[model samples]
Target chain A: MKEENVIEAEELTKAFGDFKAVNAISFEVKKGEIFGFLGANGAGKTTAIKMLIGISKPSSGQATVAGFDVYTQRESIKKNIGYMSQKFALYDDLTVKENITFFGGIYGLSRAKIKEKREQLISELGLEDISNKLVGSLPLGWKQKLSFSVSLLHDPKIVFLDEPTGGVDPITRRQFWEMIYKAADRGTTIFVTTHYMDEAEYCDRVSIMVEGKIEALDTPKKLKEQFKVDSMNDVFLKLARE
Target chain B: MSITLNHISKSYKKLKAVQDISFNVEPGELFGLIGPDGAGKTTIFRIITTLLIPDAGTASVAGFDVIKDYQAIRNTVGYMPGRFSLYQDLTVEENLTFFATIFGTTIAENYDLIEDIYVQIEPFKDRRAGKLSGGMKQKLALCCALIHKPKVLFLDEPTSGVDPVSRKEFWEMLKRLQQKGITILVSTPYMDEAALCDRIALIQDGKILEIDAPEAIVNKFPKKIYNVGADNMYKLIRTLQGYEHLYSVFPFGEFVHYTDKRDSFEAADLKSYLKNAGLTDISIEATQPNIEDAFMELAK
Candidate 1:
């Protein structure tokens, strides 16, 4: 069981002055699972993520990512994970192909490998016509989809998406999720956070954080059943409002 | 009508931010400009608020011409931009007071108007605007926008990144304000929030796809939707995308909202196809279409 778990955290905590942003949360994520990490705006989701991805040191606890200890192997953990935020994605001035090449270079891909992946990615996303267009000029949805694919240029063990579909259309949001489904199918773990509850229902397992602690973590079905609700929205409200 | 646009259009060089768009927002009604980013929702809001002139067409707010009476329109509209525009250095109370004083009003004058929302953040009045949480900043922004007591309120993507709990609270505040006869022209990308509006204009690519009451919009969806699920979502989507009779295959929560090109669709055919694809735990049920379903169909 331990070997099968890609991420395992026990009593992981982060504190600032007297406040514990992440209150000794414990969880394990299996390989190839779509795990939804959800919370209110200041519920410490970002704090926990920072710790899990090995950017921040834990106040006290034990954690491992892709089988590397967080405190001692921060660089190793970073190498095994891919992170993308909604606010900052690809370079705006760079063209679509340039952004891919730049990120691929950052990920340490060989020139030949980058060229090969560029062709596959461009064709897969149907970006042949706009391959030379600046990424900033692409439509909002297209930019987001392209950003997600670029994040996977390194093919890390797990991809962390922070509110990946913030302000896109209904179809575009679903389309981004389809990309997630495809990646998960390819045996890469997807650890994502989103505000949209409908997206939560798509997660294999969801963990909702309140204030500084995870109030509930389970399959969306069981969480709804336990909260006496039919939807993830109600379950979140029940937890956050408490 | 409280607001009207007569074939309004705007362009930024070669880009058509808004096409020949025309719509009427009735008095005291909570009308929503429902669309995603770059759908020209902000452009429409700007034209009505008199911040920007339309390339072509005429629009009026509160019976005042947007071009001729731009000053009067400015006095009667409270605009909360999609981005948080309050002064980050100012404390919450100072920002509120500054907005009130500039508008020739005071927080005391409109205390009743914003008491419900203000009280939540009143405790954080001493904090700088930049120090507040995402939800708190939104509440403060709302309070500032409402301070002048404008006849028409325009909120642009008020809940873009706020969590679900805060989003619900914000909508409730809007409903309360509507009871006071303030016409709200709010824009959002969230399709679920569309159901809460009195009426919504489904805009995309700088064009209105549909305009009607929320239920009416959902009712207008032409296709019958079905919820199809199996052991594997990715495989399920792949299989459905390959189906010869597929019209649209979207991933809804726990199922793919499947539609068919043929009117007389058979679930048995889809189920057998999935079974043959080496998938199990399949479940298919007929479902009603919602605003999202309608938007996808129209935008398709």
Candidate 2:
């Protein structure tokens, strides 16, 4: 049986001036799979995510996400996807519930659904005590978790997390991964980018970009075995050194 | 030339950034202050570097009070902030010179301190700080921090935004810097980097979680670890969690690490149980824990 892919890219390219931020990259993410996009700084991970989320236009090639054309059906694609940037994108001054409602409203969610989701998210994330508190008042890890919960308020088909756990504690990162697993179990495709190699190992499949090119794409174990390394850091070291 | 932080705590309004944190860094020791973003690592760094006054504690760098002798502290210590706080319009060489002049010292007095890192970016010394890559910016920042020959250096997440290769190279530079008998206090969010430190303090929720040598920290994980592999990985994980003896079953690469509540369970028993539950290619092996594992255990 041919498996269904939630994300498909064909030679996707993005260029700024003379530099090709993303250079002719091709890949596919299967439905409900956690696909990790790994790369060093300036390796085109963010550019690829932008094009996939229909925010930035690709310089060349064709792509489709969630069965919608990236270039032509950007609005439709945006409706079917949620995105969390590396830089926290939530309103700092807004209360936790207010932020969720605001984002849910932008996604065109109804008042009843938004209310239901707000309660469910707040409870599930154990944020009931601070549900009325401003987002800026929360700790970094809590804010990060809140940001993630807010992203999925609309229940989009796919969620794009760009370094969502960048500076969070190990315990918080573990909890975030549990959240990701729960979402994946509910048939939500997760596409994430991170500089942390250990997080990359948790994904079903990871693609490593080097200098704007997709240098390696495989399961972390296969990549490790092929590179003859014990840890993802070693695997990255080998590829980066090459 | 030792660095000492005594009962250091800082607060902004009601929120406590650093809470009663205390530690001592021996001369030439690479002491790592590791934690999440807002765990007060930066606040502690600022206190020691004489940037922000601690609410209730005293810190001394090279025997100079961080509060009373701010100028002496400033002159003897180097600080590279978490963010690239250098002047954007200044060239690499200009930034170095500017810092040197601030400390009332010339670049020649400490040229050897940054000679290795400076050479890589010497050609780009004319390039504006904003024009350089993340790695080059890191190198330039380090060069500027070291231009005055500080007896102690404080780096706050100096490798946060740089590439993997650059992070490695930067740590290597730190290793060389330690050879010059400079006490270093470095903060990073990455746990792997903690292993590079001679000693580390794991901070969380404005509290010190633990502090010891990295190896000692890992050695404290009190659990029997096992790496479990199977065909139906997801289903197997859920099933393993349902088992009465399963303490923790986290995803570890292609395997689910299954640690039992009791150390008495045999691997053969686990294999048979998994086999009966329709798990194919089932594999189990006792595994070692790392700093991350140790942190999770403590947090739990």
Model 1, B1-300: lDDT tens digits are: 899999999999989999999999999999999999899999998888888999999999999999999999988899999999999999999999999999999999989999999999999999999999889999999999999999999999998998999999999999999999999999999999999999999999999999999999888788888999888888899988888999999998878899899979889998898899898999989999989899988999
DockQ of each: 0.87, 0.57
Residue B244, candidate 2: Cα error in Å is: 1.6
Q: In each prediction, how many residue pairs overlap at the backbone (N, C-alpha, C within less than 3 A)?
A: 0, 0
lDDT of 1: 0.93
Tens digit of per-residue lDDT, candidate 2, span A114-194: 999999999998888888999888877888888888888888889999888888888787667878878888889999887
Off by over 4 Å in 2: B232-236, B273-278
TM-score of 2: 0.95
Which candidate wins on DockQ?
A: 1
- In model 1, the runs with Cα more than 4 Å from the true position are A1-3
Worst 10 residues of 2 chain B by lDDT: B249-258
